[model samples]
Target: MVEPRPDQKKGLKERCPELLEIARLVSWCMNRDYLIRSCLDHINRRLGMRARCVLKEKEQLKLHCWLGEYECRMEQMPICKESIVWKVVEEGIPVNLTETHQCEGYSHTLGEKVKIKAIVPLWYADQVTQEEKRVGALIVDSGKMGMPVSDEDFEYLKVVGELIGAAIGKAELTEQFIDSYKRKEIMVRETAHAFRNRIAAIGGFSRRIAELARDKDLANEAKMIYHEVQLLESHLEQFEKYL
Candidate 1:
C-alpha cells in the first residue's frame, strides 16, 4: 500500500485546530458570503486540499468561496440553477461524488475527475422547521487521479459538515428573525398612523359641535351632535387599545 504523503499527514494534524476556528467563524457568519468564505478557508487549511463552499441562493447554488493550489473548475462554468447540488440544498441532504456523478446534471456541472471526496451538510440549528433547506455543502477535493478517499477521511468530513451545517442554520434563523421583527415594526407604525387619523377626525367633529352650541337657535341640535361626538371619541379610545 502507498504511504500517505507527508503533506497529507501534516494536513491531518492541522484539522483539529482549524475545526475550532471554523466553528467560531461559521457560528458568527450572518450570510451566504460570510459562511462560504469561512468554510472554504477552513477546509483548505485543515485538509490541505482544494476546497470550496457553494451557497444556495434563490433558484441556484453558486461557488462563492474557493482555496487551493489550482483554480476551481466549478468556478469556470456559469452556474446552472437547475443542478443537483441545488436540488440537494433544496432537499437538505449531503450528496457525495458517488451520488454527484450518478446524476446527469451534476456530472455536467462538476467535472468527472474532480472526484468530490465528500459532500457534508451544514445544518443550521436556528432553523425552526426541517422544511427549511440546507444552506450549502462543504466540498473537499484531492487532485490525485482515481485516488479513493479513505473511510476515516469521509468520517472526518461528516463531522466538519455538521459543524458547517449548524453555522448555516444559525445564520439563516438570525436573518429570518430579524426580518420578522422588522415586518412587525412596520405593521405597528402603520396601525398607529391609521389610529391617529381616526382620532383627529373625531376631534375635528367634536370642535365643530362645540362651536354650534354657542348659537341659541341651534342649541338642541348642537347638544345631540355633542353626544354623538362623545360616542365616536369613546370608539376611538377602544381602537387605541387594540393598536
Candidate 2:
C-alpha cells in the first residue's frame, strides 16, 4: 500500500486526543436527543463556528439541534435536493464552499447576508448489516466575514460525525432492549394472573370438598390442599407487584 502524506499522518495524530474526549462525551449521553444536542454543542465550541444538526424527516430536512449566532426562523423546513446540505447527506460526502455567494441553494437557505463555508454528512452504521446509513447533516457557517474552513477542520468534522453516529446507534439499541424487557415482563404478568385464577378456582373447590367430606381423613387432605393453594396465591401476589 502507498504511504500516507505527512499532513494526513499529522492530522490523524492531532485528532487522537479530541477523539478520546468525544468518545467520553458520547458515552455520557444516555438518550438520542441528548446525544444529538451534546454533539452539536461540542462541535460548535471546538471549532468556534456555528453548527446545526439537520435530520431528514420525510422528504424535508428538519433542524434538530443547533449552536451558534444564526437565529433560525423555522425549526422545520423543506430542503431541495439541489441544496448543498441535502446533497451532502444524500451523497454521504462532505462539501466545502469557498464562496457562499456563488451557491444559489446556500444563499436561498440562509439568505444573502449569512455566509456558509462547509457541510458534512453524519452517518450511522447499521447494527446488523454494518452498512453506513445517513442520519443527518452537520452544517457549518462562519456568519458575515465568511471564514475559511481548513482541510483539518473537515477531517475533524467527519470524526465528530462518526462519534455522534455511534452514540445514536447505541442509544437506539438501548431503547430496543428496554422495550423488549417491558414486553417480556407484561407477558409474564399476564401469564401469572391467568395461573392465579386457575389456582384460586382449584382452592375454592377444595374448600367446598373439605366442608362436605364425611371421612375425617378425606376432609383433612382437602383442607391441606386448600391451605397450600392459599400460600401459592400469596406468593404470586407479591411477585406481580415486582413486575
Candidate 3:
C-alpha cells in the first residue's frame, strides 16, 4: 500500500468527527434522503471535492444524490459505453488514479479543464438477509484544477456510503412494515366496529322483547340477553379507548 502524504493523513484525521456524525445519522435519522444529503455535504465540504451516489434500479443506474455545482446542470448521469459509474459498480473496485480525466457520469467542465474523478463501490449490509450487498457507486468530482481525489478520501467515502445504503434499505423496510401494520390495524378496528354494531342490534331487540313479552320464560331470557350485551359493550368500550 502506498503511504498517504502528511496532508492526506491529516485530512483523514480531521474527518473523524464527520465519520462519527455520519454513523449516528445512519443509526438514528428517520429521513433517509436528508441523511444521504448531509453525508455528501460533509464529504464535499471537508475534502474539497464533490460527491454523489448512484444505485442500480432494475436495469438502469439512477442518481440517488449529488452535491456539486456541476451536478446541478445534469438531472441524471448517462450510463453509456463511457460511463465510469457502470464499470466501478460492476467491477467492485476504485478506478485508482493519480490525475483526473473526463469520463462519463463523473464528467464535468470547470473553466477549460474537464474533471472526472474515480468512483468506489458502495455496499449495503442487509438486515433481513444478513449479507453485504454491493448496491451502488460513489462518484467524485475533481476540483477546478482537475486534481484527482486521494485514495484515502475514496476509502472514507466508501465507509460512509456503506452506512448510507444500509440506512436507506432499513428505512424502506421500516416504512413498508408501518404501512402493512396500519392496514391490518384498520381492518381489525373495522371488524371490531361491525361486531359492536351487531351486539347493539341484539341489545336493542332484547330490550324491546323484555318490555313487550308476557311469557315469564321469554321475558327473563330477553332481560338476560340485554344485560349481557350491556356488559360486553362496556368491555368493548374500554378496548376501543386504546384503539
Candidate 4:
C-alpha cells in the first residue's frame, strides 16, 4: 500500500476526522459485544448532536440506544410501521429529512428539538440461512444544543447513516450468534447425557455405512446428517473462540 504524504495525512485528519471516526467505530462493531449506546455516544460526539437507535420491537418502535441533550421519554412509540422513517427502515433504505414538517409519526412536541435528520435501517441476513431481515434503525438528529437542524446536517447524517448501517448489521449478527449459542447451551446441557452416547454410536456406524452403503440416496442422507453435526460443532468452536 502507498503511504499518504505528510500533508495529505494531516489534511485528512483535520478536515475529515468525523468520517474517519465513523470508519473506526464501524470496524469496532465486528465484535458483537460493542454496545449500541456507546456507538451512539461516539456518533453524537462526532456530529455534535443527538443520536439514537430505534429498534422495531413487535408492532412498536422502541428506543434501544440513545445519546445527547433531550430526554427521549417516548421509549415505546406506537407509530405506524408504515410511517415515513419507519417505512425507510422496513424497506432497508435511508430517510433524509431537511425539515421537521416533513417528518411522519414523530410527536409534534419533538418537532422543536429535532432538526434536519437521517434515519437508516440496519438490515442483515439470518446468520444460519442468510435471509434478508430488518433488525433496527439508527436515528441521527442535527443541530447544536440550541440551533435548529439544517440541510447540511441532513446531508452529513445521511452519509454517516449508510456507513453506520453496515456496522449495525455486523453487530446484530454477532448478537444473534451469541443468543443462539446461549440457547443451544441450555438445550445441549439438558440433553447432553442422553444424546451424546446415541450420537457417538450412530456416528461411528454412520461413518462405516457412509463408505459402504449400496444405496446412493442413503449414503447422501448420512452425509447430510454428518454435515449438520459439523455445523453445530463449528458453532461450538465459535463460542469458544469468543469466550
Give the deviation of candidate 3 from the true structure as CA RMSD.
4.9
Cα TM-score per model: 0.67, 0.79, 0.77, 0.54
Cα lDDT tens digits, model 4, 126-169, are 66787877766777764334334344555555555555556667
Q: Worst lDDT window (10 residues) for model 2?
A: 1-10
Write candidate 3's Cα lDDT for 63-182 as tens digits. Answer: 778786662355564444346567677777766455543352453222323444767787666677887666777777554556666767767767776777777787777998999999
- Best-fitting candidate, scored by lDDT: 2
Q: Which stretches of model 4 miss by more than 4 angstroms?
A: 1-17, 28-34, 71-83, 104-115, 127-130, 143-156, 179-192, 195-243
In the range 143-172, model 2's lDDT, one tens digit per residue, is 665775667777777788788878877877
Best candidate, TM-score: 2
Task: Determine which window of 10 residues in candidate 3 has minimal summed lDDT.
Answer: 104-113
lDDT of each: 0.62, 0.75, 0.72, 0.62
Give residue 9's error in model 2 in angstroms. 16
lDDT of 1: 0.62
Q: lDDT by residue for model 1 over 135-227, one digit each (tens)?
A: 666667665533445555666677677776676666667788899998987898687678767756766775676675677657666556667
Poorly placed runs, candidate 1 (over 4 Å): 1-17, 71-106, 110-112, 130-132, 144-148, 215-243
Candidate 2 has what TM-score?
Answer: 0.79
Cα displacement (Å) at residue 208, model 1: 2.2
Backbone clash pairs in model 2 (N, Cα, C under 3 Å; residues 3+ apart or in different chains), count = 0
